[model samples]
Target: MMILVTGGARSGKSRHAEALIGDSSQVSVYRYLANP
Candidate 1:
C-alpha cells in the first residue's frame, strides 16, 4: 500500500502523516517530490 500526503509549504503535512503512520510495524517507503 502507498500513501501520498500533501499540503501547502510549511503546513506540517509531513509531521501529520508521520503521526498517522507511526504505529505500524510494516515496511514503509517514502518518496519526496520537488517542483521545478
Candidate 2:
C-alpha cells in the first residue's frame, strides 16, 4: 500500500504522514522525494 501526502506549505503534511506511518507495523521502508 502507498500513501501520498500533499498540501500547501507548512500544512503539516509530512508530520501527519509520519504519524500515520509510525502507527503502522506493515511499513518497513520509506522513501522521500523532493524537487530541487
* lDDT (10s digit) by residue, model 2, range 1-36: 888888887888878888888999895455566778
The stretch of ten residues in a row with the least summed lDDT in candidate 1 is 23-32
- Per-residue lDDT for 18 in model 1? 82
Query: What does the lDDT come to for candidate 1?
Result: 0.77
Q: For each candidate, how many residue pairs have backbone atoms clashing (under 3 Å)?
A: 0, 0
Would you list the C-alpha lDDT of every candidate in the order shown?
0.77, 0.79
The sequence of per-residue lDDT tens digits that candidate 1 reaches over residues 1-36 is 777899999888878778767866787766666679
Which residue runs of candidate 1 sit more than 4 Å off their true CA positions? Answer: none
Best by TM-score: 2
Task: Assess every candidate by TM-score.
Answer: 0.60, 0.69
